[model samples]
Target: MSSSKKARTHPQYELLYWPGKMPGRGEFIRLVFEAAGVSYRDVSNEEENGMKIILDMISPESTGDSDSNPPVFAPPALRIPGEGKDGKALLIYQTPSILSYLGDRLGLAGEDEAEKAWVLSHALTALDLNNEAHDTHHPIAVAEFYEDQKEESLKKAKNFREVRIPKFLGFFERVLKGNEKQGEGKYLVGSKLSFADTTVWHVLNGLQFAFPKELGSRKKEFPTLFETFYQSVQEQSRLKEYLASDRRFPFSQGIYRYYPELDRQ
Candidate 1:
């Protein structure tokens, strides 16, 4: 990916996650960088043996690295050069934490302390929905194959489409309505776009892919959310280009998966 003029001054941010087409949690961090028009190295996607790099980063046998940075617990970690002790690379994990850290530097956190807090809060809530969506397809166990728990997945997906989806979508709809004075029904926090908006938008986009029929039927019920907020976030100049570009991978067997049997009949 080409770097913008503004991105040239910043450190080369490296994203370490599972390789290939799945957006996964790394997409959250990607959105922040894309929205800010900043450049970052999607290490696992761009470099050879990049998946091995992620495996080594999260290896159980390793306690810490030579750079004195603590071991990451999982994928989607961010490595920033010259940000650690003695100018070593700073390594951080956890999707929410990584997004928050980048949010501030990228100017997507919010304008002030209160907006920042709300931004994080809203982002966390959206991630909760993302996790719930994942559970629908693997309700019995994460390590086990979905086919082994197909029966359970059916029940889980049903409850998710009928209950959990509306719960989360309604909550966000109300948030946008409440913030309409400042956000004009397009943002979840303050006036401008924040990481929270992108975070929530991505989750909603995943929901559409995972449960097309369900989301299609429910869109009218949450006009502000599905119509205004969702449409606005995608139309953002940089995000619009990124969404259409090859960089934005299609939704597949990642956090969001499509199963016709799991979707609405």
Candidate 2:
């Protein structure tokens, strides 16, 4: 039978995301790589590696002698280097796709086919919720800043807190509930950790940081999600250390923002 595990070839990966680390779409992939203890460059186009990111994506010159596939609209892409020095595959767009590829490549995915499918399902579910959380701020105007959308954000945030949060929370709870029924804990799958856990942790961190007032009041309501989030935070040694360290960066400019007016109850 073919091996489920893949050999690590090159650690140098070009993560084409925005410059800063805001735990956005790219973060889902990063959390897995971080957890698996893999080494990567994490090149972003807008922040630090902005120039190269631009050249690699939109710049036709970078295509060289190979086929082209740049990101459709924005960041969170991957460039897996090939045989020679500059030989790479331009994997563009979509969070779930990137995470799935990274998971299989790193051998941090599921055990069997069923387990892989289950983990991926939950992982995609988490991404859906992440996008929803982002929509609260830019629900009305994606082009404008949070300051410009405060009024809509305030109203939208309330809806997110009351309606959206519970619905998604319930979905996650059931996933956990299902896992428990199958006699599993610690992670989202029947046993070991997977993409689902990391995605949950990232969203929990964003929600708690962005909407403290609503998150605080409504947090205790989602028992399983809250508890799982807390446990994930505690047990994730590298992530915990990253949270405390400067490498993980701070939350200010990305998907989840802290606008005092929007945060309060």
Candidate 3:
């Protein structure tokens, strides 16, 4: 039995995130689980005291015990109960790290060492794009409200729309073209669907939601590589159903906020 296959032992998986309608970083992890047909409890929505649960886990008090696990700095953490070293709970945090770990376990990272490295590299790049998109609306500081930094956000948004978006999209397009030349199939890293493809799809989806007008106008520049890749992911039966279902949260004040003032063509 392969390790990846063995990892899917039907262990109790719980995702800890903010309880809201908006899909923040948690959505990326959700997509992987959904696509792999792995069932997990979304504690943020299902549990009555999900937020409190997360707080207690990350609190200083929780880490005082010699047997207690290390603290996770933020939300979108995955908790595998009784699966850690010495029978402790295993908590994985950070969007990229969590997704990469899940990808490896779910056979979405890649088949070999070189392909796995490429997948990680591309996934990190997608994360970079996601962060940049989020910063468009919260340029000054995450602690401050969007209204508090509207002026700075406008400048940042303009620069992002004019410069950063194109650079990232263009790089992906080139990657797609290169992959095609190498006969690696339509997916990003290899002929098969990998986590890198899913991460890129999420970033593109977020971009379209945040800057529909701008992305629409620039659609002709990158050819159909990215669009096709995104459509391919959407067509996956499990993911398609998840996307249309209520389980998939809509974009609002989250990372991909659509502010008319910040949007441009």
lDDT of each: 0.93, 0.70, 0.82
Give candidate 1's whole-model lDDT. Answer: 0.93
Candidate maximizing TM-score: 1
Can you tell me which runs of candidate 1 are displaced by over 4 Å? 2-7
Best-fitting candidate, measured by lDDT?
1
lDDT of candidate 2 over 16-59, digit per residue (tens): 77665556677777777777766666666235657566455655
What ranking emerges by TM-score with the best candidate at the front?
Answer: 1, 3, 2
Between candidates 1 and 3, the one scoring higher on lDDT is 1
TM-score against native, each model: 0.97, 0.83, 0.91
Preferred candidate (lDDT higher): 1 or 2:
1
Q: What lDDT does candidate 2 reach at residue 85?
A: 42
Candidate with better TM-score, 1 vs 3: 1
- Prediction-by-prediction clash tally: 0, 3, 0
Stronger candidate by TM-score (1 vs 2): 1
| Candidate 2 lDDT score at position 157 | 79
